[model samples]
Each structure stands twice: as structure tokens, then as C-alpha cells.
Target: MDLVLLAIVVGIGVGIVVGALGAGGGILAVPVLVFLLGMPVHSATASSLVIVLITALASLPHHARRKNVDWRNGLVFAGVSVVGAVVGSRLSALVPSQLLLTLFGVMLVAVAVAMLRRALRTRAEERAEAEQALAEDSAAHDPAAHDPAGQEDAEPVATHDDPVLDQPGPDMVDGADGIRHHHGEPEVPLSPAAPAAPRLPLVIGAATLTGFLTGFFGVGGGFIVVPMLVIALGLAMRRASGTSLLVMVVATAASLLARVGTEVQVDWVTTLIFAAGSAVGGMLGGPLSAKARPSTLTLAFSALLGGVAAVTLVQTLLG
Candidate 1:
């Protein structure tokens, strides 16, 4: 296939993936530029940052309108991450490409494993909830299910809709992508509660690490940021995803600028064409993501990570 054609095709896919999955999208870009487009790894990484920045910007509005973004928190994370990105970009010049590839392969495997584990856990939790609901229904219908004292009036068991249980569950709609609605399930509304004290440190640490990776590898840092938001900060998955794009815009811009005239060199013609395709595809991915089941998406992402890891490992080993 013609190289320009290939870049355009791959760019669209990368943008959609970013819109759908956030951070991992940049991983695909680096490999495509290196192996398919015949660019050196360093140059590919720098170019990938530029593409990632544009894709994030393109996808931002979709999530923003859905109220998925936490601008204050996003800015905090982005601020710290930008510092790390600058440091990482400078260090990238000294690292051997082979070593970088090996490290990236390892990182991919780790992400795949983490994704698969989370998927399995989510499935198990859903199953448990179903079983509990069934048991409650059975108990409610049983003649002897009343209070042992046989009081004339008894308190009813609280249901999923109870205020106490109103906390977001795994199956809760993360409609940040603007597509997957379940029988009119409402979007998980954002809480204005302050993050816990412990969460502040965790967010700082994770954001810093995410930024460093973005600069070093020319990735958008969404994969790491999204999960951290979900796990550490208690943000809904959709909110985490939307907020991730906001953070990426800043971090990637910093990383790209750091590489100017230093690490990233490209044929502006091919780069521009690829970026345009990516921007268009990014706009479409938000709606598609809303339709996808979280479990299904997680499993698919896991598989993709594993496949990429295998390919990277093999290439790095052979080279």
C-alpha cells in the first residue's frame, strides 16, 4: 500500500481508538509510524504526540457537552503531568531505541493484564448483583419472610434505588462517549464532593507518571489517566474517559513542543493528511463508545494490548 494512504488509514483508526479508549490510542500511533511508515522510533514518538494532541482536542467537545469533564481536576493533573512530560522528552534523546521498545513492550503486557483482570472483576460483580436481586425477590414473596416479631408494620428492605445504594456501580452508564444508553439509563452525574486527602497524593503521583510516559513515548497518557481517575478518584468510567482527553491536550502539547527541531521530524504533507483523518474519526468515536458495553470494551482493549505487546516483543527481540 502507498505510505501516505497507509498513514491516513492508520491515523483515522488511531483517532477513533483515542476517542473510544483515550490513552492507549497513542500506543497504536507509535507502532504504525515506526513499522508501517518507516520512521525512526524517536521521530515516530514525537509525531505521535502531535497526532495525539490533535485527536484529544477533537474529541474534547463531545465529552464536554456530556459533562464528563472535571475541568478543575483535569487542570490539576495536566499541570503536574506537563512538567513530567518535559523531563521525559529530554531523557528520550539519551535512551537507546531498542531499550525503549523493550520497555514499551513490557508496559503493553502490563496494561493488557490489568485490563483483563478488571473486566473479569466487573463481570463477577455484575453476576453477584443479579443473584442478590433474585434472592431478594424470592424472600419478598415468601409467606414467612415477615419480621420474626410479626409486627403489623415492618420496615422495607432498601433497593438499588435507595439513597444509600445510589453510589455509581460498575454497570452504571458512563455515557461520556455519547452513544450507549440502556433503556433510558441516565448518565452518571458528577459529584461535587471533594476528593479524599489520600486521593490527592495518588492523583499527583499517577499524573506525573502518566506525563512522563507521554513525553518519553509520544503517547497521549489517557490510558493511565482514565484508569487512575476511575480507581483512585472514584470518577465514573465515562467521566474518567472524558476528563482524560482534557488532560491529554495539555500534556501532549507540552511534549510535542519540547521535541520541536529536536526529536520529531516529519513530512508535513503526510502528517497533515493523517491528522485530518484522525480528527474526523475522533468525532465519530464518542457516539460509538456510548453504545459499547464496558465489559465488552474492556475485554477487547485487553486483547488489543496483548497482541501489540506480542508484536513489539518479537520485533524488539529479533532486532
Candidate 2:
């Protein structure tokens, strides 16, 4: 196959993956450019940076429209990571390429393990929640269940004179946020609590590490960002993915700027073609991501990470 065509195909696949999961997709571009298109690693890295930035920007709109992008948090994370990106860029030359690739492989494996464990924990939590809800529902309905007043907590009987009373009088309904609501009582709107004070430090630390990886590898650190947002920030998977892309756009752009006037070489024509394909794929993937089940997405993302890690490990060891 023609090299340009091959690159475009690879780019499309990477873009789709990125759009869906928010990270690790663009990392494949470097290997494809280096191994398949036969570009040197440095050139491939530079070109991949361009593609990563373009692809992230392309898919961002879809996420924005869906209200999945957390702009405040994303910007904060990106802003902090920029400092780390600059530092990582400066240190990139000091590291050997083989060692860098090996480290990248290790990082991918670690992320995969973390994702798998999270998925299992989430599943167990959901199961426990379901059982608890069922028990509550049963107790609410059963006449044998007594309240603290020692009277059976039976459903209230409606009087013909008060037609509204015939309808199920307000009993306690379990809410998703672990709050229970009494039907007859005025519902207290439990407003969203202020952002947790403790999360700022966690965000800063994660973003700094992510920025370092982004600059050192010439790849977006979505893999790191997505999980951090989900695990630490309490964002759902789709929101985390969207926010990760937003951060990637910032970090990758900064990294690319750092390379300006450097000795890096790029094949602009191939890069453009690949980027075009990525843009198209990204558009398609965003909607699909929002529709996907979180557990399924997490498992699939973990598998992909594991696959990439294995490939990188073998290549690094063999070469």
C-alpha cells in the first residue's frame, strides 16, 4: 500500500479510539510512522504531535455540544501541565529512545491494570447498590415491616373523600446520591456541594505527570488524564474522556510550540492527509462514546492498553 494511504488509515483508527476513550489512540501514530512508513523516530514524533493536536481539536466540538467537557477543570489541569510539558520537553533529549519506549510501555501496562481494577470495583458497587435498593423497596411495601413507631409500615389507604390520599402517599424514596426522600415532606433540594478542597492537589499532581509524559513521548497523555479525572474528580467516563481531549489540545500545542526552530523534520503532506482522516474518524467516535456503557468502555479501553503495551514491549526488547 502507498505510504500516505497507510498513514491515513492508521490515523483514522487512532482518531476513533481517541474520540471514544480520550487517550492512548495517538500513541499508535508514532509507531506507525516509524515502523511502517520508515520515518525516523524523531520525525515521527514531531509529526505525531501535529496529528494529535489536530485530532483532539477536531473531536472537541462534539463533546462540547454534549456538555461532556468540563471546561473549568480541564483548563486548570492543562494550565498546570504546561509547566511540566516544558520541563519534559527539555529533558526528552537526555533520555535514550529505547528507554523512553520501554517506560511508555510500562506506563500503559500500569494504566491497564488500574482501569481493570476500577471496572471490577464499580461492578461490585453497582451490585451492592442494586441489592440495597431492592431491600429498601421491599421493606417500604411490606406490611410486616414496622417503623420506629411500632406500627406496621403499610401503604396508606386512600379515602374516597380525599382522592389524593388514595394515590400512594409519599413514602421514602431512595435517591441515587444516597439520600432518601419522604413523599409527604417538603423535599429539601440537596444542592451540589462545593468542589472538594482536597481534589486540587490530586489534580495538580496527575496533570504534572501527564504533562511530562505528553512532552517526553510526543503523545497526548489522555490515558493518564482520563483515569485521573474519573477516579479522582468523580467524573463519568464520557465526561472524563471529553475533558481529557480538551487538556490534550492544550498540552500538545504547547509541546509542538516547544519544538519550533528545533532540528525536527516532518513530512507535511503525509501529516495533513493523516490528520484529515483523523478528523473524520473523531467526528464519528464522539457520539458513540457517549452512548457506550461505562463498564464496557472501561474494559475495552483496558484491553487496548494492554495490547499496545505488549506490542511496545516486544518491539523495544527485540530492537
Candidate 3:
């Protein structure tokens, strides 16, 4: 029952939770370190950052080794996110812990529901695409599937523009700033449209903000960030997972810096134990996550969020 051994245990437990469930464990780390181990909030916060940082760093290499991460996309998102995280880290000093926890719970639940819906829609679309491909395959295999009408020459339609109505693009139609005026399309198409420029800066800004929340409120923010990437940014599941780990690393790093030179009583042993469990789980989690149906991942994520909220609430109430 040595002190460092105790810290390692806590660390490994937190790691296991993050790897298995992907969030909320980080938040628990601060409180446990402070209460059970008698570390002040400041010291506990810093130490928790160390734990999160190590866990994220360890987990990230696996994603890279598996070639699961899109480096360009992750780096772009991380760049913008650093600024937001710095701002958030500063703000963390001002916000009360109770309020932060409450907000975190609300956000977690909301994001979970949104992701679940998206997973369902993705599944339906995938199924439809599969059926279409099968039908096409059968048609191509059959001798009579092709019709004479399919060989008909189709004429291109002429473009018409209204000088008063449409905005210009490409051509100087009607002298409207040399822009083409293609008619009959939504002014700004929303999500589900064809992939446009990747919003690398915006994604990074979001991650930074999320990082600040992590430092301030002790939230990992992976739950929120992961869904946002999938739904808002249109990133795939593995991509979201990889990007989240990267952002987590930055947030933890900041927290560590924020707590340096403080007399923090870190239960190194506990932390180490938690990190060990998480390391193994992290490796297993990624491939399992990839094979999971989107809907299942979404649903499971929501359930975990709820479970974490319940645990926090109970602890808060009992305390």
C-alpha cells in the first residue's frame, strides 16, 4: 500500500475506463485524487492531467500504427483546437465545479442522442446502397437488362439566369460581377451535401474549446467531440476516435503545465494501474469500435454517458 503504488492503481483504473467507455473517467480522476488521496483541487487537477496525457499518448500510437488516423485531418483539427483549449483552460479557473459537471452531463446526453440518430440514418443509407449495387449486378449479368432507350443521345440543357434574382458564380452573367448565375439551387446547401472544403480550422477551434473544458471542469470531452466530428464534420467513426485522442493529449498537457511546482500528492501507483488497464483496452477498443455498427456505437455511447452522469450525481449527492 505504498503512495506511488496507489497512484498507479488510480491511473490504470482511469485509463481502463477511458479505453473501455472513452470518457467521464477523466472527470472522476480529479475528485478521487483530491478526496481519497488528500490532494488540493489545484494539485489534483494537474496530476489528473498527467494521467490523461499519458493515457492519450499511449492510445494515439495504436491508431497511428493501425493507420486509422487521417493525419492531415487530425493535424488541421488539432491546430485550431489548441487556441480554443487555451482560452477554455483560462476560463476553467472561473467556473464553479458543480456548474461544469451539470453542463457536461447535459451536453453528453444531447450529443449521444444526436449520434444515435445519425447511426440509424447511416445504416439505412448503407443498406439501400447495397441493394442498389446488387440489383445493378444482376442486371449486368442478364442479357436483356439493357434497353435501346439507354443508348439514346441526351442533349445538354441550356443555362438560364435571372439578373435580378440569382447571385453570380463563374460567369459575368448580366454583368453581375463576372459570376455565373446558375438558377434553381439552394443558396447555401446544408449538411449531407457533397463534401466541400474540410473545415480544419473550425474543427481545431472546437477541439481547443473542448480541451479547455477538459482542463477546467475535468471533462474529457471525447463524448461530445467524437459525435460532433461524425455528424457536424462528416468524419468517419475511426477518424473521430483518432482526432479525439489527439485533442485529449493537448488538454492534458495544458493541465499538467497549469499544475507544475504545486505540492501535489499523486498516488502514482493507482494512476499507473489505471493506465495499464487502459493501454490494453485502448488497443482492443479501436478495432472493436471499427467493426461496431454505427447505430450500436451511438447507442452504447449514449448509455455510457448516462451511466457516468448517474455515478457523478450519486457521488455529488452523497458528499
- TM-scores for candidates 1 onward, in order: 0.82, 0.79, 0.66
Candidate ranking under TM-score, highest first, comes to 1, 2, 3
Which sections of candidate 2 miss by over 4 Å? 130-195
Candidate with best lDDT: 1
- What local lDDT score does residue 167 receive in model 3, on the 0 to 100 scale? 23
Give the alpha-carbon lDDT of every model: 0.76, 0.74, 0.56
* Cα lDDT over the full model 3: 0.56
**lDDT-superior candidate, 2 or 3:** 2
lDDT tens digits, residues 1-319, model 1? 4877888888888788878766576787877777778778777787788788888899999989987787877888899898899999888877898888788889888889998997787667666667888997898888887767765665433233211123443324446644222223553344455332336788889999999999998888787898887766656677778999999999988987777667447666666777777887788788777787666677888898899889888888995
lDDT comparing candidate 1 with the true structure: 0.76
TM-score of model 2 (CA atoms): 0.79
Tell me each candidate's RMSD, in Å, in order: 6.0, 8.7, 9.8
lDDT of 2 by residue, 6-48 (tens): 8778788888887887776557777777667777667777788
Each prediction's total of clashing residue pairs, residues at least 3 apart in sequence or on different chains, is 6, 2, 40
Q: Which consecutive 10 residues in model 2 have the weakest lDDT in total?
A: 161-170
For model 1, the superposed segments whose C-alpha errors exceed 4 Å read: 134-198, 261-263
User: What order do candidates take by lDDT, descending?
Assistant: 1, 2, 3
Give me candidate 1's TM-score against the actual structure: 0.82
Greater-TM-score candidate between 1 and 2? 1
